[model samples]
Target: MSTTTIRVRAPSEVDDARTGPATGRLRRRIADNLTAYGFLCAALVCFALFSWYPIIRGILLSFQQVNFVTAPEWVGWQNFATLFADPLFGVAWRNTLLFTGLALVVGFAIPFAVAIVLNELRHAKAYFRMVVYLPVMLPPVVVAILWKWFYDPGPGLFNSMLRAVGLPDLAWLDSTDTSMLSLVLVATWAAMGSATLIYLAALATIPGELYEAAELDGANLWQRLRHVTIPQTRFVLLVMLLMQIVATMQVFTEPYVMTGGGPEDSTVTVLLLLYRYAFTYNDFGTASAMSLLLFVFLGGFSALYLKLTKSGG
Candidate 1:
């Protein structure tokens, strides 16, 4: 009787042991999936509200005239036609392209060089990185205002430094010749911080053995950097290039705050002109049209860049 009772209890105990952990694991997996889905749903909702909604609204507005005073009137392609007819439209595009080119030449290379230097340093890296990134921490408006003061013809820091060294002060923003380049400098200074940190992270990921192998093969610093470092980080470089181009093309803040598209509209940009249409001119349709064009352009450019990079890779 004792043996039979023990056998019956053993079977039930084994079943409980088998099911207990499996049930717990199933519950945990369900909980994890629920949490992941909750976060994803929230993200989708926010993008729908903020990003997608505005894009759809802008697309609609591009087809209709809205001044907030009258009922919106559908105008078909009138807005785009008007944009093309405007003289400043051409100037805005030209200046925007010029600025983008200058920024790519200046802004894209400096951060990489700075990152390499920082990575090679033996001491006080954190301090230098913070210093380099400090400009980016400040507000864009504040940065523009600060640089505006620095570029002031009468009492600017740059002029002061020039005078201290007995050199003549150039018309940094007042002259059309120097205005765009000056703005590029301001932008490059303000944006290089994050790029530098990203590059530092990329640099840190490179395996030590490859670099050691390069050294053993009698490769110098530049050789190793070209052959080892750059090849290893080609994907990163391509992505950063695309990002920089996109960002430079859409630049607005520094020019807005500093130049106000002045010095004979030498600093006018596409976005700045778009702002004028929306608020200054009260032609939301034209503004929307310009934004749509810009959006399509950036989208195409991004696609092309990614394709080319992928193929090259």
Candidate 2:
């Protein structure tokens, strides 16, 4: 056999070899953690400055009268009392509730129906989806302005169409009876696209086998939708319902832009009233109180909803 040779590494050399990569890896890991934490801290600081600060400041302002010219004056529950005494307060709240209810009924169902139709369509889906989502992509102010034009009592697009059909022109935005409903329709049209897309995504996630099984069992189209599709999308439906409620309850844009809280104040919403208090009336205290009330109501409602849904699940 050829002569065998063996080389022994020194203990120091062995230790250095063993520790070199480990040390480098440890340093890299520490650096990565530091970088990640730095980003997170930056995000926290931004949120603190913007969101938390605003919320805290509003709460404090709710108990104090602060006009830009004068120093803030502390008043205990006076702003709330003022709100209670104001007659328009009750009307604003009632109209806000009415808008939320009407928007929910119309805005909620139409999106789901549209999503279902889109999911079923096999031809030119991309084109149709673009059409549906076009409104959502447009700026809210532009949409409100465009619809305002459409709702014009004379020579408006809707009135023109009505006249073409030999029907009398309805006072869409002028009459109190139709004003809130008109706002609701505009809100629905503008906001429904996003909800429809979400429903479509949820529908797509549903397994196809269930539908095939339903068909084999002689279930009709409605039965398939009722049994297979609905149960599968129940979670999405509940979540969207809550979000829609919250969003509609805070509606201000359409009413402020189109109606200006008019038609006998029938279209006034909570946010529109809050805006008036802060800007028009120069009463920041009352505006803060209105905001606080809205926040509390929404927080409690959301908590209760989550609890109920958790238990049901």
Candidate 3:
């Protein structure tokens, strides 16, 4: 009976009450977004300054001629034309392709094989892993110097071993036939450790039941590898293959330090040629042009890789 005197609130008041919490939540979300962006600003600034700016500047420089003393002058496609006309351009590309190919065949395959073997081993896994990765920890300069000594024609470890084993002594780095191979061998040795560890990690992630299932189906070692192991790690293999190609394309230090692009320029790589263009030739525009060309090539390859991976996935 007392409810007869009850007062009803306005519809607008009720609506306001319902929306109050949602308004607070929206404000809080806006504040959170602002905070996140504030935190990201520093990294964004650094990337713009150091990475993106240089890339843009390099692109601009490719079409301009500039030395430190004078203002940059636009030269259209002159730099690119000069680059193409350079005799070393073809040689550099050829050597780079050869290095990439050999590295894929030897460096790429060896690491995966090593990883497979290592994954199967239950004994001294840590020791073996350490041994395999030790070279990667060594400084690149140190590795280069050590391998230089190893490849020495006289009193070198490799030739000494050959002598001890009564095998013919081969010029590891001196011969035009073997200089590039020697570089590949050293690069593989120093670099394979990382790939091996990566493959090992990838292999570990694969389900044990896959291997068991294959075995139950009477799959032998080779069959299991073909059907299960490789397929399971195919994504990693493709990524590593692309990475190796990119890396070998830019090879410079090994050829510079080991052979100085010697044995009739057998080891001259794209990066080494770029270095000579910039430093030895003092042609910054041409160097920038070469850099742009290399960037475009690698970028195209990366796009293709992404397309393939997306479709495969």
Candidate 4:
């Protein structure tokens, strides 16, 4: 009789254990769904308010002649047509490409190279990094002002140094020929810090075992860099290249503050042109159209980069 009672109790306990877990799992599922839905609803509201709304409004503005006071006139493709016909549009596009190329060469490559060098340095690492990054932390206005003073043709640090060295005092920012290059230098100086930090992080992630293996194989510094370091950091380099392209294409502040798109509109970038159309001329339609064009260009390159990376992977 005692044995039979014990068997009955064991069956009841097993049933309870199974039911309890099922009930707990159901409760957890409900909680998770509620949390996910809550976040989704919040994200949708924010997107509707900020991102999607402005994009739709900008697209509409691109088709309409909108001055601040009057009702916007539906102009169809007139704005785009006008943009293509405008001579400055060509200059803006050309300057944008040139600047991106220059930035890639001087700004992107130099900082990556600096990061690699710093990674190899075993001593004074913190001091060297701080010194290299100090210029980037300075206010943009301060950087622009300081560079402008140094770039001055007469009695400027640059020209004075050149003169002292018995070299020609070439007009750096004053000339249409060299204004873009001069701005590139300043931009590279100011932006190198962010790139260096990213690259240092990437370098740190590389497995030490790989380096040790390369050393055992009698690989020199150049061979190790080419075979090991580069392969490990290829993704980072690609990401940086795309980022640099995007940033360089949207360049405005330095050129605007330094040259004012001057020396005969030679330094006029797309952003500068957009600013002129929107604020300087009060032509919202054309400005929106120009902005749309720039957006499409950037989007295309970004998509291409993604596709290439995916294919490579």
lDDT (CA) for every model shown? 0.94, 0.93, 0.92, 0.92
User: Residue pairs in steric clash, candidate 1?
Assistant: none
TM-score of every prediction relative to native: 0.89, 0.91, 0.92, 0.88
Ranking by TM-score: 3, 2, 1, 4
**Stretches > 4 Å off in candidate 3:** 1-19
| Candidate 2 lDDT over residue span 1-313, tens digit each | 7998999999967876888977867877999999999989988999999999999999999999988789999997999998888888899889988998998888999999999999999999999999999899998889999999999988799999999999999999999999999999999999988999999999999999999999999999899989998899999999999999899989999999998999889888889999999999999999999999999999999999989998998
Query: What is the overall TM-score of model 3 with all chains considered together?
Result: 0.92
Per-residue alpha-carbon lDDT of candidate 1 for residues 117-140, written as tens digits (9 for 90 to 100): 999999999999999999989999
Give per-residue CA lDDT, model 3, range 155-220, as digits (tens): 999999999999999898889999999999999999989999999999999999999999999999
lDDT of 4 by residue, 1-313 (tens): 3554444457756766778977767877999999999989988999999999999999999999998889899999999998999999999999989998988878887998899999999999999999889988899888999999999998899999999999999889878888989999999999998899899999999999999999999999999999999899999999888988999999998888999988898899999999999999999999999999998999998999899998998
Pairing residues by index, what is the TM-score of model 4?
0.88
Which of the numbered candidates is closest to the native, going by highest lDDT?
1
TM-score of 1: 0.89
Candidate 2 TM-score to native = 0.91
Report lDDT (Cα) of residue 11, candidate 2.
Answer: 93
Model 3 alpha-carbon miss at residue 193, Å: 1.3
